[model samples]
Target: MLTGNGGHLQHLCAQCTSCDEHAPSLPPESIVQMPEQNTPSGRSSQICSDRRQCIHGISRQTNWVVRSSSLPQRHHIYKISNHFDPIFKLEAPDQISTDGGTNLASEEMEAFFRRWLVKVHLSSAQYPESNGRAEAAVKSAKGLLQENTSKGGALESDKMAWRQHASHGDQRVASCVTGYLQLKEWTNTSGIDRGYGKNNVKILHVRREGVVHSIKEYEINTQLTLNNDKDYIFGDNSDIIATDSQKNTVYILAKKHGIVSPEDFALLLCTHFLSKYPYVEKAKIDVDAYPWRRIVSEGKAHNHAFLFSPEIQHTCTVSQRRGGSAAINGLTGMRVLKTTQSAFVNFVDDEFRSLPDMKDRIFSTIITASWQYNTVDGVDFGKIWANVYKLVIDKFAGNPDTGIFSPSVQNTIYLLQKAALDEIPEISKISVTMPNKHYYTVDLSKFPEVGSLENNEVFLPMDKPAGNITAVLGRATKSKL
Candidate 1:
């Protein structure tokens, strides 16, 4: 039964009438009158009712009722990991915080329980009346998680176990529980950019392609203090042309001159590289120009572009990775570090997970710079350096996200870069490279596959690609570590 925003119960018939002393009122489309008390089947919470005055045994109404009746129950699950705590708290403090606190504070007891209660009112599933029942479930969950971790199962295993135990009843209840659990899991585990964290990444390579341009300019005819007491006169005129990845169209001169900096020059190069390309929303510039200098004549700096010898080589790279669940990568490889002070511990245990000692030191990172802007306006080198400097030092000393870390070098790099981008607001994205070394073990077994165990084939090579690949994520840079 339903009413306008609320409910309105009318009169109830004291006795059931079998078409006696009652003119058979036409069976209305729906029933609005209250149930009579004498009937075997009184209004047992109105299986289905509307405001009309008809009483039908059953009717097909909204699909929701049918769907609810056929739904399967689900139990909500969550993680209690080292990195899980800080990420839910500090990563996006503004967005994640509720109730005026940085911690993962819940609004009410129900709110807290609701996250794990998939089928809240399932007819078959039991509801925990006291904290003890919840605690017992948690203990079991923790054990399961620990077991999974010890067996090297992924975090998803923990969540899946909870889901498998949820109720299977009506569709409505099942859907509600499924949605609630998923939301809670995602909210808890999803990084700033969906579920991707540094652990989900691979490599970041930043490259500065080439700049193309031609210049014709005048030389400085200045009288300077020379060894021969002669006026040091530089060339009076010059003309040159060059091209590279960026076809920086250069005007000879005498036209409108634009203010240029290191960043500006870099942008010019990027503009040329991307102008004729396809599917590029924008280009990120990286200026790894070999250090070049101009002559100082008569106490004035001469205006000249630094040129590298054709025989020598310099390197820079730019890339992008964008999708809802995909990583955002642009430029990487500026600064990276692991602090000696951080630690990991007290993670939730499950059937397939394990927990390390809380006191054991865990690694953290301060990724230096994100990607350089490949544009003429110029990158804020000052800002880039500032972020790099601060993160390199601060990430180690302060709390860093611990969830994403692993003993593997790849995991560390990914997590650090992710943190750098996530923690720092300015940096938009990062690209990264991680190397994995294969440690080979001597085959002591007399026979090959016949006697060999699962991990018996120990082979370690520093130059191998065992899941080590470059990752290019965007929306990284200039952010605090």
Candidate 2:
């Protein structure tokens, strides 16, 4: 329902369109099956009249070109010319405000309205200009639709139509985000906090950035067994390897061991120290690696690199004690954004909540992922990095032209970790932290004409107070399985 400039209630109805390619796919159950029984797709050819104050409830005419019961449930996103024609065919208001759902979202859907010269303004659930009227309209409309469809009543079409409309949006309507919700339901009240235990090697919780080595560079931090009662207690420097020697060892060993990948180099350093100094009990080491590329000379990349690009960096950590086995981990950073096909909605609804359910939004995030390796054997670190990197990135940013639907950073990051683990068995557990980079649409209500012209093209970026989301996923243990 839309509140007019005069502060009067104006009713709005849903037009359930086909799946948006960018929209997260709905559930298998939610895939609408055109029923065998004949029920008119409620629609009329009458065009909406130009009146700010429209009718109570508009009769949404279904412009179904094909009326076949044999039509299989939709699997792929297709642009139906006039599919799920909206109920607003009768009275087109100056603007239609939706609490949430597919309207004024997809390019094709927008084009459908452009042909009729109707302005599409997406109302924010974060900031409700109509106070509570926008929410009231959704609640009241849903209540009526549910009442009509109770016990499989005659108005089942209304229920079906409503669902189809809702499906065009995120979790509430239908999408992959629903799966995360289901997972959440199965968990404790603390909400999706997970931890894994592997009994061999200890984890060295150390991370330092900007390490320089070669074209590939790293900074190493080590925890040496300095004081062990008898060793350093007697003022003995025998067991303790000199810091100066460690420095020389790094430079001298670089020629013999060779630099391949960050993980390999890190493993080399930790193993060297452990093997050389037996009296030194525990040795925990961490390395951060960054890449540099050659500048483009004409059309080809120069043989000798000159410049550096700010791309995803790799992380490595190795911990080895005297008798215990070694533990090594790898990590990658993904800085990405999609102009469309991401949303945040259906969160807490308390007095403290000011942000609304944004149906479509400018979503960008700096994804930081770290995963523990199953074994520190002769693994191809570079190949594994490339494989996992492609999988994580491709899943988030689909084809360059079109991006996969990402409802929340939590859900998206979960998918990223899941994809990496499922595809690569070398990693046993993975954790990803994605901070929501918010871009608010510039308020164009002041200039309605300019707003209609520019549409959602203009936006304001936010740097401070970013929403932080993190999740950890691990493979099931044998006993649990």
Candidate 3:
């Protein structure tokens, strides 16, 4: 069954470690005897516990020492240390309240402060009160223009109106400053005149050094995909592969979009290699396809055409490297599932901490996976991404016995990425990043005392901080060949 450069498979076998099979399955009798454990009162009953009833697989009030293996032996390991310092200055301000003991509304004071800062320091120094001058100039110019204009034809009248409007705008600055100065006391205005005028000789300085900031406001374009024909939908699938034995250099099998569907339009955006630039036999070529569907939708339930959305996704990538250069890339989303495979333990504790037991708590995070493809020389490139996604999911849920129990988010990421590398016939390794979005339940049974966590009560709060982020890196092997 080996095709095209079969010797490459032999080299892979030599480099790979032997797969181990130590997974155990429970006996049938034990399953029949297992009774559902339910409590009459607490929080939620969804939390599961082992036969030993340990919360999250850890004991409470116990300190676990962590040490780095790379450290020098001479350095003495310190187990636990605690120090305290005030996080913020809580001293009362010295400002006296003018309005009794009633607290001032911060919103009103903040607005007034912002206005003061801009008007006093930001306005032009030479024309501090330009409002009075701007208003008087505008009024004098408008009065002079109106005094000369007479009733005339539509065209003549329009011309006179335009001239008057422009003349008014020419004096707008003097009018604005004149209006602002009217609000202040005329006696207080002596200070403004003394600062700018000297020896009854006026001096003018052209100040054009002021900086003007322009914020380019933009609207978030959410509907980025252009499916004008409504072609791509939930259940649609496609595959593109390059085959050496086949007559065609590239072969693609895509599900037909809905009649007048633009699903393929979205696909084209995603597959830049195929759409932006494509090739067959080292020559540029455009993709040619004729639409075909299994059944036409007459009403509800016509033949099982591609559904709008499906819970399962299966994709694969296969490529042959010209110079022993293999690359893998993958993206996985919408594989939604609800499980309590997550657990949290190994955290520092002090006197302020009052968490119940650290035995069996549910830890969960939504998973998003993307990885590059690494190909061995002359290996099957048709099914790489598909295999990678499948292997990762299988390792996460299917191999619970060996994969993620008592596992940190970092451990889960390493295992998931490794599983993908294992089945990827030629891929050397994979890089993965996983964010741990914590789903915690609030204990709200009692007012002061939070409900005991042991009663198996659980609630999910969405607006909370995400857990730790873990990433796996792939290191290349360099040899002097």
Number of clashing residue pairs, candidate 3:
48
Name the Cα RMSD for model 3.
Answer: 37.1
lDDT of each: 0.30, 0.52, 0.31
Number of the top lDDT candidate: 2
Candidate with better TM-score, 1 vs 3: 3
Clashes of 2: 9
RMSD value for candidate 2: 31.9
User: What TM-score does prediction 3 earn?
Assistant: 0.33
TM-scores of the candidates are: 0.25, 0.52, 0.33
- Name every residue pair that clashes in candidate 2: 42-61, 42-62, 43-61, 43-62, 44-61, 60-87, 125-356, 126-356, 213-217
- Per-residue lDDT tens digits for candidate 1, residues 1-481, read 1111111111111121211122112222232344343433332221211112111111111111110111012211133223233322222111110122212222442354244321122111132222122222223334444544634556655344334323334211212221122222312322322110011111112222344233322111101011110011222111111221122222211123432333443334334434443322234333333323445578865554434332211223332222111111132333333433334455567787753444423242223233433331234544554465455344333345542234444445555566666765555556555433333344547677576644433543333434344565566237586
Ranking by TM-score: 2, 3, 1
Q: Ranking by lDDT, best first?
A: 2, 3, 1
| Residue 376's lDDT in candidate 2 | 74
Clashes of each: 81, 9, 48
